[model samples]
Target chain A: MIIDVSDPADPRLADFVGLRDAQLRRSEDRFIAEGLKIIERAFAAGAPPRSLLLQPRWLDGVLPLLTRFPDVPVYVGTEAMIEEVSGFHVHRGALGSFDRPAEATWEALLGARRLLVCEEIVDHANIGAIMRVAAGLGWDGVLVSPGSADPLYRRAIKSSMGASLELPWRRMGGAADLARLREAGFTVVASTISPRAVDVDAFEAPEKVALLLGTEGAGLSREWLAAAGAHVRIPMTDRVDSLNVATAAAILAHSLRQRG
Target chain B: MIIDVSDPADPRLADFVGLRDAQLRRSEDRFIAEGLKIIERAFAAGAPPRSLLLQPRWLDGVLPLLTRFPDVPVYVGTEAMIEEVSGFHVHRGALGSFDRPAEATWEALLGARRLLVCEEIVDHANIGAIMRVAAGLGWDGVLVSPGSADPLYRRAIKSSMGASLELPWRRMGGAADLARLREAGFTVVASTISPRAVDVDAFEAPEKVALLLGTEGAGLSREWLAAAGAHVRIPMTDRVDSLNVATAAAILAHSLRQRG
Candidate 1:
């Protein structure tokens, strides 16, 4: 279904408004991915598009993508209309709306030996980086805490190089949800800078392990650390205190996977 | 000396132009640290300010800072002039220009058991984050390879929470520098994603160790790996290939420090 609309206020374009809001919600449910390269990667990775909105100039470039998702609707609008619809300047030439993938269950995500459980990491870019690392390093999946930023936010998707769409991940409401992992034989390792924390290297990878990280400012809440099977600290120089949460998570993920 | 310059074209303010350009350079001889709090922290850390440039409204707010650095020139400019001089609008109310600190020698930087050797990691934010982690975790210092971005770049410094100014660090010219480290009894561990690389946790941290990190996209170069005493990888799942370089570096630093 190819529909041509010249108006920016078209009701069909509601999915792409105020992307920053979606980031705060911890869900990409109402977000859209822009650009041909990103959309193609998502499609190649088996992500189905809900619809395609594009300018006439992009038709030639987008026709090839349309062939893949034959049933997906393609909406054509003027450049001026798209600018108004997106509520910002977007010169990406093409955009696509896709339904957020179903949330993965703890069992589904924990099937792999190495996992990351993000605690209150609210930055979209950091979430994206974590997903990229997770996908790049072959981590099974990421379990994002409730307060963490949405991985599907436009900036995050862009930062992840589309890996947020490809990586296996799920969101947990809070620390209580994490308890189930331990019952399922996953050793929860909380990464912190506390004095009593064990060296990250000291932990031998168990049959299954979950690396927990929090925001850089406050670090992991004491409750989360107390619940962990072990508190892990990355050693550092006396002058510096902590690594960014995403960076620390990646290192720990890599370490755990190596041990496994 | 207090110089009141009504004109924005004064040549004395040349160092503050195109602040963004500082990040592109191989080395920034000087950079601005904005915000009163960060400037205070830098001063407390013994980083001398080269000059204090401020708006009239902030004159009283910054008078105390000037007392500590009587030798440093203090420039008061009108709000319009300061904005024009900075090229971009800054709302921090004041800015301080600081000369880049003298580079530390490899021996001085490697005084501790653990050190960070960043090889060509160009992102300023990543460099800053690494510095912050290095400082927070009590690492000795950072050694930057020739191609790496300057740690003193404005954004880098800000992202580091001003720790970049306080951290003991040096810049090595090339592979020969690694050779020098080896001769100095520092074990060089290059981080890569190669299947054959030993797990990061398994790599022993010698009394003196330099963890080598490469640019984010390409893992450690072959020459670097060959030159390194050991090639280590953060274990990750099959889907995720790597972590952000800075994150990887921090994890490595923390791990080495913990073991030490």
Candidate 2:
């Protein structure tokens, strides 16, 4: 299972090609786990390894993770060759290909007391950071709008520090799912910058709450804001209009946590 | 002031040469404001305009800002030439060179009730985002360790939506300044991941606060933490060790805000 590869054109290394070329769709069956820590996280998440391309120095560190998958190919290459295969420099000289984890079900998300629903948040890093905050703060689940970025993309996973793999999340089939979540007895709160919105802290937290966020440049759309049962704004000075969506998410997640 | 420049090598245009080059120092007297919106923000800040390199298509929009500084040269170029000079694709065909605003004095920072103290948080984007959150949430001033990234760096300015130019900030001469801030009647609070730290919400918000942030990778050093009057942490599940430093700053800044 340990194969040495000097040729960058080896078909076995296809999983890493054009990773930084900006052409590959990130929603493929396999997702990349870059760097040493994430590779370990992938195995810990019970991800099925497709292959691992690394250098000789990294072989021992990866051996423990591969004990269960002795048949899985472990490709070794010089640092230069590995860089040539992957579009960018592989951090710590490791790249992992693992089958993407299955999305969590709607019924599963409904079990949590606190959840985050992203409305068209398209940046991979923001999506990943939101997941990191959601998971770290003990939020039960995350739901992404249909147009959201793939959380399994390598950069997103890296930004989340691998929390995207552990967090229970799913892409909503459509916007109507917002109403469906409300029908399930969850208070859907939309974050906005509108003047009439109540201060975030002044609004009381309910037993089951779903906090909604929006994209980077423009905030929650008119249609989405009107759909929510309540609108809350982070009180701020007039000098700056809004915080980064991810930063806003962290603030809201921390503010609205259920006290023990 | 409208000068036609076909040569990218023109000495008068040295302010913008290799703008995107990694090797260039960004702490110069003039900071770049890329994109039309930031360029307009720079003008709105009453920032002194050194020059503007923009395409002819953007001329009409920029004309209003240049009327007061008729002597400031306006270099006109094709989109291709602008990219060649700046070392990257110029976002929407505009880059402005504005004289850096002066840092705020110690007296000015102490005059405010709430302040942010950053210790070696050197990433340009994080510095910018911190400033944006600080400005948005009505925080008074910011103090950074001498090693922090220049908030006026082009990317930082752009990331802060030009709040870096508007926010009051300065670098501390030494870590002793923490004690100085405390002596000035500020409650210096250090953020950390240590489990023994008090939960952020449980801590009382003093009349005056100096929320201390740590470096990007490894957090606040031992010396700085010992100097802080209080230690607070955002309560979280044991999944991730810590949130991104900027995200942590936003949550703490929001959580510990004076309720007045």
Q: Which candidate is the best by DockQ?
A: 2
- Candidate 1 lDDT, tens digit per residue, A1-260? 68898767778766655544664434445446778867776776677688888887777776787786678778898777777777666778688888777767766876667788899888889899888877866677888988888888777887777888887788887789778888778898888888688866677777788888889879988888888988877665555455666777766676666432
Q: How high is the CA lDDT of each candidate model?
A: 0.76, 0.88
Model 2 regions more than 4 Å off = A20-24, A55-57, A78-84, A88-92, B20-27, B78-80, B89-92
The TM-score measured for candidate 1 stands at 0.81
**Model 2 Cα lDDT, one tens digit per residue, B1-260:** 99989899999899999886523555577888988889988998999999999999888989898889999999999998988888888878988998888899999998788899999988888989999988988888889898887788888888898899888999899799988898889999999988899998889999999999997568899999999999998898978767888899888998877667
* Span of ten consecutive residues with least summed lDDT in model 1 chain A: A22-31
Which tens-of-lDDT digit does each residue in B1-260 have in candidate 1?
Answer: 67887777788877666666764433666667877767776677777678878877777777787786788877888777777887767777678887666887755764566678888878888888888877876677888878787888777887898888887888888878888888778888888878798976677767888788888778778888889988887665555345667677766666667442
RMSD of each: 4.3, 2.2
Candidate 1 has an lDDT of 0.76
The TM-score between candidate 2 and the true structure equals 0.94
Worst 10 residues of 2 chain B by lDDT: B20-29
The DockQ-derived docking category for candidate 2 is: medium
